[model samples]
Target: MRFELARLFLLERKQSDAFERRAADGSKLNREQWLREVFSQEIDFIHRKSERRFVPDQSRPKGEQRIVARIGRKTLSHENDPNDHLKEITREQWRACLVIIDPTSHDDGQKVAIETSSIVGSGFGNFESLITTINGHSPPEPFVIELHSITDQTTFWEYVDRHKGKITSIALEVVMPNMFGGSSSFEEDAKQLRDKEKARKIKETIENEDGLEPETERMRDAVSYATRGGGKVKAKAKGATPYDSTRDKKYIEADVDSENRDINQKTEAAIEAFNKDENEAVVEKEV
Candidate 1:
């Protein structure tokens, strides 16, 4: 009755002859739209009727809109634990098919043309058999891979690399951020401001008076200490490897306390100074 079962019959079992018989009996033109209609009906039914069954079963709240196969929560059932049920229906078994519902603009009367070719290029259609072959009993996990931006390839690789071994279904969806007001100026100005802010931070940190100052007061002290015999104290303390000494020019001691009260006081002061400097550094960045 479900699309998944129909698909399983058609693809996995190769029952085209049987499919034609069922299609005629069901009064459907062809199997494809019939399958989609069945799937839509099932989704609607589950949404309206399955709520009570799902309430206690699925403990966690789902996103506002989500593909049930990939991100939906599961509940403990009479048959098995939640984990076992989820393991039975994992993303590793099938791929996903996604469609983006972009928000339309009433002001400019313009729709952003998202390049779907790249998504198609990413082997989206390769999962047609998988999607068709799914059974409702154990639907393969569906990943709604939404491209928030066409220019950003990082997100694409992240999804691919992260789920290379586990992905069964890949549904590509894309949506541009909804624009507000009758102006493109806000978006353009925001971009320019971000670029300018980045440049300002880079220039100030590199070529300004603050750039000449030590990053932290403790760092200054550490530099001074290194220049004096204090560097040898840090260099020789417990766990002082040549590599560690060369890089940090400081000691690493697990169980050793300060050798004297004077050293202890300086270390305490240095730590306090370092913490103060760290906070001030963050505050400066915010300003």
Candidate 2:
């Protein structure tokens, strides 16, 4: 039972399409309201267009993490498609109470204590992909929404501003590289450096320079341990639209495994009842 906040922005893929299209009031239709409406579609839409669900079902430089919604295949059968979890919708807002799980992690049992958020799960794209299938093509205009974990991220930029130069260590999520380094430095060389200088160097190396010229890469989040004047004053390193410190908050946690959060037994019972009723009606008609 986790909650998240997200906002959607629409982008028109075709400038020509934008020129030809307008809403009822003649305002340019660029808010991706159409995509929003798609998510609000009837529950049956899930089954009608369900397919091999992907983490980000759209726009990837490489491949996506395959989201297994069932025991063996891409989607569940004799049960509900988990994508039907859209709970409420309005012109300005929508809510989805999704049940997302990582089967492998739970099975491994280091302790099944993490809650997989929709932002880091197939919940983002499962329904979106189905809508595309129903439409027979991709939406000319698509929407992008952002979600950040507020848990473990109690401190905001305001705190950082107050502390300023006191920042002891800042851990960042290295987002995109201008050019791929054959040997990338994923983590800091914590063994060699000393004091506050270590933290500064870790951040500076990625953002300031490679050797001579500086091609600063975009860091997704920065997690700082603490800021100390002399003592070990600890602060946590978080994200840009930053993710929280919890293990479940990271996308990599579920990059290899996936599961549906839907109540299988409840759905199965409903399906059974429907089938029984249908069979009875057919028998009466035959008689």
Judging by TM-score against the true structure, name the best candidate.
2
Model 2 stretches with alpha carbons more than 4 Å out: 4-22, 30-36, 42-139, 142-152, 155-287
lDDT tens digits, residue span 1-287, model 1: 00110001111222233233234356523323333323332221122121111111121123311111111122433342376653444232221222211122222111111111222222122222223223332332121111111122233334434433433322221121122221244234433543544211110111222212222443333322222111211111122221112122111112224565343343333333333433553575369
Q: Tell me which residue pairs clash in candidate 1.
A: 57-75, 94-168, 94-169, 95-168, 95-169, 96-169, 96-170, 98-171
Model 1 clash count equals 8
lDDT of 2 by residue, 134-223 (tens): 444333433222122222233434444554444344344221111111122332232123132323223332221211111123221223
Q: Please give each candidate's TM-score.
A: 0.16, 0.28
Q: In model 1, which runs have C-alpha deviations exceeding 4 angstroms?
A: 1-15, 19-28, 41-71, 76-287
Judged by lDDT against the true structure, how good is candidate 1?
0.25
